[model samples]
Target chain A: MLLLGKNTQKSVLIAGLAACLLAAPAQAEEIWVSNEKDDTISVIDVATMEVIRTLPTGERPRGIVFSHDYSVLYICASDSDTVQVMDPVSGEILHDLPSGEDPEQFVLHPDNRHLYIANEDDAITTVVDVVTRTVVAQIDVGIEPEGMAVSPDGKYVITTSETTNMAHWIDTQTQELVANTLVDSRPRHAEFTKNGTQLWVSAEIGGTLSVFDVETKAKEVTLEFAVKGVHPDRVQPVGFEFTEDEKTAFVALGPANHVAVVNADTYEVEEYILVGRRVWHMAFNADKSLLFTTNGVSGDVTVIDVASRKAIKTIKVGRFPWGAALRP
Target chain B: MFLRTVLALCLSASAATADVSVVIHYLRQDIEQPPVLSNLDPIPEDLGLRGAELALKENTTTGRFLGQTYTMEVTHVPPGGDLPAAARSALALTDLIVLDAPAEALLAVADLPEAANALIFNASAPDDSLRGADCRANLLHSLPSNAMRTDALAQFLVQRRWDDLALIAGTHPDDIAFADALHGSLTKFGLRLRSEKTWAFDADMRRTASQEVPLFTQDLRDHDILLIADEIHDFGRYIAYNTWDPRPVAGSEGLVPVTWSHVVEQWGAAQLQSRFDKLADRPMRSRDYAAWAAVRSIGEAVTRTGSGDTAALRTFLLGPDFELAGFKGRPMSYRNWNGQLRQPIPLVTDRALVAQAPLEGFLHQTSELDTLGQDRPESACTAF
Candidate 1:
């Protein structure tokens, strides 16, 4: 069930403000990047394209996400095996949640209170409730679960295990696996479509993306990317995001060092925009006018202009940056 | 989790028979080594065997869900023991054999008539001949060959534009073989060997390392990097700072190209380290990883093909569809031509991963991993 809370109201207000400020471009949002090696978060002001602040985090922070209302942030400090809740405004850590071992990536359900975390070492998906800071359920999953995602309808959550090569689907209401869908070797990330009809899973080592019919849990398509002058082994597809209208998708090809613009309707690659080395994940600005990619090898974020399809600026961050999220 | 998986299997088995049964035989013969000069710990006694054990545990965990039973029988031959006879008996029981033996012993067992339907994994020997003229159809190599290690170093050197190199090789047989392998890569990468020397001193290195090393390398030609080829973990540790020209030492010493290292903490490897450490109580080594991969390959083949038939498993392993999550950032697959597992070689120092090869811009027509070792065109074996 979707919450009729300030999160929804704030999104509407942010969208309206984005539209009005499109011409002048004075207001600012922040692209927060999690540095896996340095244990820091580099906050980049959208207006200036510069790193505004570098805040300390728990050891080896990898995955990061903002609350829907843009009030707080969740950082997965992987090595510490705990999730830190931080006030984005004050840059103060509120407290830590009981995340299982090696929490690499996670998803915030539409309800905004439940977080599904992927515990890589334990092979368990730990669902935590934010209000009580208590673990809701610890569901046993496949080996080496790395990526976590929730459906738009908030009915199911998916965990992509790197070793098991399967996407384990858990029914949110029951907190148990309803389906286990096989993907290619080493599935790294998964996401549902905006309409919640399709589930997209990226297999990092397989160098392909698997799309499934969400209702039937059957694979609909397998998408492969081939960047010119790049070897097939290096063309690893990881994190992905869609355009505002859901017509086009921008996928981060890990180690291939490029982002592929794809036609969502046809499932065809349109163009490859070169980025930094070993790009892991991405986050779009509030207006969808800018895409920021965290390059793990280069330790920087490559900001791409969404309309022009060109890299506008490179903002240096801490070492081995893994994930990016927008707070608008 | 294992208990849960087993419980689920018990519930499923009540309705159906356990269909898939896989039995593996693991063999090893640790050869004598020169006393290591450095103070670091020696290799673990269960180097290759513990890896096979870990893989067995993993296989059973996955097999529990798929209604399969997996087991591995281990036999470690004493040094200078009759390895071939022991291997013959081990091969008679099962077709899947994981071996950690010398090249001669592996070749001897591979040539056995009783091993006609068997698949053997070369998990210890880094010999190049096994990947070349003496290659066997039934044999698969999980360990990186000597050529792969040297080629990885060559790629890192080329990426750094370190063209001219000087070589200091120990007198051990493995050291000579590693140096021989490096010579081929230096020629292939168009790098110059400005000076080459073999260690001939008989003094105790701990007492006279600083005094003897500098004078030994003083007359050498100018070079950009110093290459040490001491595979026995013997004399190379003393050659780093004692080199006359202050060149960076690499190869088997300061900076190394390895199949697996404790320093590899990226790309889901940290979890693997934690898992292995939990099971073995120590960091995983190269041989352990190779042996683990060998056992897991069989497990993957049987799980995917849904049968214990040797031909089917072999076909699946050598096919293009085979992909193993090796925790090396790249999905590894066996080379169909020579049965060598294709993987990324990590170039590391003592405490950090410096880089992984093939480095940027080292492109290949097929796979970037193919550039590290013997490609199809250069491979001498007609066996697959």
Candidate 2:
């Protein structure tokens, strides 16, 4: 309660500056999306719901992800067949990492240095070390690999092949496909639970979500979605996110124009929230109170209120906006 | 037997360790394609078979993990050759046959005693009779029928609010079939046809199209769309950009209904197109996609039942349990009433995809896709 002296105030100021240095990235909080068709990334301010910056990227920029520390961003650059590392602060591309052929999707390993990328055309999962900028391994998985996910413990990496209809499990230590688990046809995205106890995969063509036990690698549950007035074929389950408590799930049903609110524990759909057309992927905000969905067909992002399960705003983005990443 | 086996597969749920081998017998007839008016893109020598090859490659991708193996044995019949004899021999090896031939030739093989147990996929013919009165229990159609194609066109046109319609039907049998189908679709969709002309000219369309097309279409009351029913690819190409009234030409020429096209780059179709281009060294056509779908249908069955026994496979195929990832932005399935693959028909030109049918508002009792082709009520087949 007492007033501080001038000497004490100067020392406190120095300590505060040191903490700010350690924290870094004190800029505006934003959500970045890779526009596939436009070959650009749209950076939208989370607070203002407006595009703050647009950075040119390689051909067909998709599957965007921020580094663990939110320092750099990695873009798939699918048509260019390379992974582009970019400085998020300056919007300058740092370098190109060899990403085999048609790297459509990828997951950065927990090591934060290695990226396991799905080379779709080559039917192999390419592991590239970001620090070294070299290919660590190219493990053969299945044909037309699209979805990539890494376990929380970094012990297992999963690659879901679109045509093969199997999720190829790669051992991070051996960099080999230790097991292959068959799922519904045309599996597109793979996601692991927060605790890494379960793995959920979305099948775009199959119109189903398959959940597997992480330990035994056994399929524990299968969730199917059917929204009224939406064609079953159009109800393609693509990308999904779990709520903060991991009790609820929001699944993006591509072309169905709806995001399904599901009870994660019961594996039942609670409600359907109508969003933009052909919703591809989504990213939650820092507080987990708001979710941003990338609508590929409509060329917009639907910001949803998590608690109410309602779309609060529509943020127009570049053409065919694909992947979403939050910079917090 | 199929139901029990599929149930076992469902119960096992984990490991499918049994090596299920499937051999698809591809029987193609080498008939002289009707002369086309365009020389820009020539038909590939290996058109339909290339699609089957690619599908086999794709099936093997899933088969490798599911303990299944798929191989294709193709036999090409020379023009005016004994197709039934060739089909009989192919059927001796395997009951799963994919036939790429004209409607009559397909019927000749389907009616054979050996084919009674065989499951044949018609990958080339667009004849509606094959899906209707002439339907066979063993023979299923992967290719869209003439009615399906025309209905897709009709849906596209109606959804775009194009009301006035005129038809230029060729005199060939295939053309007549297509014209009839289009006429039926026009009526089904409640769009009145303003005019109908039969193109019976024996002169070279290449030389006379510019000179004769205007006069040929001169007498017609100008309509919104001139649907050219040149299913054989003759004269239809000449109609576009040469119409007397400058009307848009559809049907076989401009924005045609096709099973697959290089122009379709949506819904992950670009990846498929790139793969096909790499394999065949040319753009994939409708026939190629038909064959691919046919082969993939068999693969789906084998994966589901985990066995290659044709009878069990057929039972599973005709049953409601089968769904195919058709790359058509839909989970395609066979119609039990007529054995036609229910899929979204892509209406496209050689350049770009105009739209996919079952457009937006076309509704049906069961499925919106059912509004495109001959629905369950309209199906006249008693095959099942």
* TM-score on alpha carbons, each prediction: 0.90, 0.94
| Model 2, runs deviating above 4 Å | A1-25, B1-15, B36-38, B203-207
**Over 4 Å off, model 1:** A1-28, B1-19, B36-39, B60-65, B203-209
lDDT of 1 by residue, B1-384 (tens): 211221222222111233798999998886776776666867788998888898887777566556678988989889999988998899778999999988999989989998888999999999988998999999999999999989999998888899999999989889999999999999999999999998866754445665788988998899999999988877788888887778889999999999999999887788888889999999999999999999989987876777899988999999988988898888899999999999889999989999998787777887788998899999998987
Interface RMSD of 1: 6.5
Docking class of 1: acceptable
In CAPRI terms, where does candidate 2 land?
acceptable
Model 1 captures what fraction of native contacts?
A: 0.23
lDDT, residue B252, candidate 1:
91
lDDT string for model 2 (B1-384, tens) is: 101100011212464567888899999999977766567667788989999999999888778777788888989999999999999899888899999999899999999999889999999998888888889998899999888889999998888778898899998889999899998999999897999999877654445765778878887875888889987777777777777788898998888998888899887788888889999888888899999999989987887778898888888887877888777888888888888998899999878888898888887877677887778887788978
- DockQ score for model 2: 0.24
TM-score of 2: 0.94
Model 1, A1-328: lDDT tens digits are: 0111113444676676567668754547888899989999999999999999999999999889887766788999998989999998789999999888888899998887999899988878898999988888888777888878787778989898777777887888878776666678888888777477888899998899998888888888999999998878779999888777778888999989999998889999999999999998988887688999999999999999999999988989999998898876
Q: Tens digit of lDDT per residue, candidate 2, span A260-319?
A: 999989999999999998998998876678899999999999999999999999999999
